[model samples]
Target: MTSEEEGLRFPILIGDVGGTNARFAIVDSPDSEAGEPRIVRTAEFATIDEAIAGSILRDAPVLPNSAVIAVAGPVDGDAIALTNCPWVVRPKGMFNSLGLSDVVVLNDFEAQALAVIALGVEHMEKIGGGTPETDAARVVLGPGTGLGVAGLIYSRGRWIPVPGEGGHMDIGPRSPRDFEIFPHLEPIEGRISGEQILCGRGLVSSYRAVAAADGKTPRFTTPAEITAAALECTDAVAEEALAFFVTCLGRTAGDLALVFKSQGGVFLTGGIAQKIVPALRESRFRAAFEDKAPHSQMMAGMPVYVITHPLAALAGLAAYARKPDQFGVATRGRRWRA
Candidate 1:
């Protein structure tokens, strides 16, 4: 065995922390004899540190020296703040309290973006467009704890993840109903972001708007319920709501495609896309996706797929730990504890 393989013994702790829950795991090196890293228990705490403590208690031979956590929010340098949840993740302070050597905290979207580098045929469900070029830029986005957005730029035959707070971008309406709905939502205006209309709360709000448009009492429904009702074809209002949702998603996705000029394709991840694929496929999604102004046709040729693996982000964390140098990860602070 090569020294590169033999020297790989960095016991790492990795996690994908979102608004609702924090998922964690510990890996014993990249090519060491460690078995599959198991999930530590999830915590319902309000802060990242509390959640980290709970996860550590569930499974930890010892606190890890090298750790990386992907959190759902805009990572402003070392100060991380989540929009949907009440939590602030401070990497430097946590490292001191936890007695760890090194820790890297990245935007959850960034982590998901890194995870996209390791995606395979088994992890995806193709939705539309033709095959994409292998070495072109790819857009990675999804509706989750909030609408998370990121892009992967392939250069020199390697994938580089460019993370961003893209979900905070402005959202516009194309349909007349949407235009009418905009006024009632003016309170949100610039304050309201894509996450407000593209996430779970967005699904609920969309459903309510459609229902109210038909002069009916709005029925409370979860995003899952909205998707299921649409797929089952049991309610016309539900179907219409879903159609609008997909179209909006497509439009935002197209915007990202334009921003990145992603010829590699657009990859849709997160839990929400997996549950609503059928509705999305049948809706105005592809049409809206290709509705780019002058470059509409160009975008129509870009492939779009929904990632289906439940533990995809986990797999990404593993791959990143296995190849930190390959991922351009900068580990500041102390060295590995002996």
Candidate 2:
């Protein structure tokens, strides 16, 4: 390696910017080159730019020109807008403001998908299906405040991330209970995306619907509380709600796998999926995932991985930074240049 690459400084600034919070890290060089990055602190800042600016000032004498940001938004040339956050991340603006030369912007889920390609069995919790194959196409979905979806295709001996607004797609009811609650939820139906029933807030909505069905007034609770109650088997309504949620997730994952021909596997990420692993294993998720018209065996053979790594997205950012050439731009084939 040349001195430019070899002498590249340690503690590169990396960030995983989400709607609610932005996680900043000072990573040492890649494992092959240097020691594992010791996190200075996973500082929480109010906005994406602020978090990044703060991390930069605190970690090094000056900010590095090249930065890869994993943002929960759509990447459009020089302009990027987050789906959930109000921050508008523009590469040109950041460049002019920070006096940087290169900035890499990628869809958050797309970044996650990239990281999934590098993830090993130890980094994941397998819920069902057989072993994962290297050549197979894979799907990565995360349910948080919103549902994020991305497709990973094997091409040129590397995984390519194709991010889409899969969460905004129409959500269909699969069971009688779902149908029964449909009219009551009509106020939110057309306006509601898959995020309505597939995210943290969606858990609250699910619990409310089930509570109403049981002839009990609906009570509000956070997703964490709901999951805890269901796990302990103390709340039958919560359990039922969670069961339905898992089934829906499975059905949707199956649909995505079929659509993308994700023979590689399906990876479940996000805060909610990690917490509800036990319930998901016990629910009808696997059965629902495999319950297709004529491709039941195909879904059954597909491996499902639940991402357990805390810095999975950051790992993706690092991977992108290390090999930016592999990303090869978006579908339109637009290259990012100053």
Candidate 3:
């Protein structure tokens, strides 16, 4: 490991912190997998320190001295706040209070991007497209607490993760039916961003918009309710909402693929993508994805897969801890050393 890779000690705590839940595990030694994660609802605890103390430290077999965390928001300055959740993370306070030596935080999708390079075949379910080109640029995206997007590139024989707020990009109606429902979809900053209809609450809003378009009251108020009703074929409006959600996801994925020329493949990670595998495997997603004009043929040749690993983010963090030289992960701004 180079000087830039210095400071992550043995028995490190690795976590994937999102808006709704936080999953944590311990990497005991070199080249070992992260231990089974302890997942807890974010709202159940007031802060990250409290959550870790209550859920992980209390029952841990071995205490971790350092930590590498992936949070669902920008990691800058002394304090990092989650984009969707209310918790604020102060690395110095955490290491001090928990008796740790160091801490590193990353954008949630950046960890997902690293997970793509670390994960094997057993952890992935292919959705569409042809063979993935080895060592080529790729995209990793997920719709969960929010629509997260990141890119992965291979340069200087190292895998680098590029994380950003690609979820907030503008999305407009493409079809006659979309024209009807999109107008009803809620907007932030006076226009519809992808997160307006991609995340959990965003999906609920989409369902409501679908109902509003037809001048009918929505039967489902939550994403779970709408997804359950759609999967069971219990409600036509719910089904339509699911279709809209997946189609938009595919469109956005395709757009990113175009921008990055992601021939290495496009990976979908997060609870939502894993839960909706059946819907995503259907024709709607691939159809919208391959609908890119003039570049339809190019889009058809790129592969897309859904990550099936339950604790994928921790796996990524552990892999980097085990071999920091292998991945060109940017940890400078987020890393803290005592």
Candidate 4:
């Protein structure tokens, strides 16, 4: 194995860079337990380098010599600007800015995929479906500032993460109600993408569309407000919108499951899933998911779960940092060395 494949340097800086929040942790050694990550808003810093310098460097237990970062965009070239946020991340720039000898940048959901392997039953709640087949492929997706999708394949001796912009895939009206709401939902580049109905802003947009369809005004402007109203049964529009969100998530997840034939499982990560468990449990999510015709029986056996662990991405990075040989993370094009 190559030296880079052997391992990254100790005191490695691990990060999960999402569109809205960038979480960072320091793995001091192979046996070191990761502490609470230092989370800073993406809006608080113009660039990733500046965020690391301001939020992670000053208080890190020890200066890190290397890093493994997951970002919410395609991992290619040296410069990465997140798909949903404005901050740009330059790995070559991190060498002088963060004092790193090695840096590995990967798609954010790839980190989520890694976490799916490491996280145990306790960190997740099964939303529905049957047993997960051991060693089978797995899928993970979630709605935060954007919708992220990834898959995990257990190969000859290691787990490989497959990340893609599956969130941008086409979605359409499957139900009679969907016909009414789908037309009003906002679209990106003139067509409704999965992310158009699945992300944070998407929830608010869908809520507004629901209101407009019913000849009423939207009362909630944020995802949190809509979720709270749905949970409390305080607003009909919020309740319907939240339930619709759950259904869309289930359908999208099932679509991804079919894409990978992920019998291992489909994991729901991020805060939105964790917050709206009630709706997920009670909504038409399962029905919509299983409505895929002749393959419905096959999809029925695939488990769906809500990941409850807060620092899943960091946990994934630490695993990769601690034992690089265990996961076949493709760092060929993305890894940079000083």
Clashing pairs in 1: 71-108
Poorly placed runs, candidate 3 (over 4 Å): none
True-vs-predicted CA distance for residue 178, candidate 2, Å:
1.5
* Candidate 4 C-alpha lDDT tens digits along 193-245: 87888989999989998998899989878899999998999999998998888
Top-TM-score structure, candidate number: 4
Instruction: Give the candidates in order of TM-score, highest first.
Output: 4, 3, 1, 2
Return the TM-score for each candidate structure. Answer: 0.88, 0.87, 0.97, 0.98
Higher-ranked by lDDT: 2 or 3: 3
The local distance difference test score of each candidate is 0.74, 0.72, 0.90, 0.88
Candidate 1, residues 1-338, lDDT tens digits: the string is: 32222222467777787777677777776674323444432346756777766656345775566676787876666666777777777777776666555666666776777777776888888888998887788888988768989888866545677878898888876678888665433226456577877888788887887777667775556887878888898878778777877888999999999999988889888888999888678738898999997998898899888989876777776787787556644333312322
Worst 10 residues of 1 by lDDT: 329-338
Q: Which ten residues in a row have the lowest lDDT in candidate 2?
A: 1-10
Error of 1 at 219 (Å): 1.8
Per-residue lDDT for 1-338 in model 2, tens only? 32222222333455677766666554455553212333322234444556566655455654565566677777776667777777777767665665555556667888789878656779899988887776788999988868999998877865688888898777777678888664444235357567788888888888887887667775547888888888899888888888878988998898999998887889999778999899778749999999997999988999888999877887776765655556533533222335
* CA lDDT, candidate 2, residue 81: 74
Better of 2 and 4 by TM-score: 4
lDDT at residue 134 of model 4 (Cα atoms) = 91
Candidate number of the best lDDT = 3
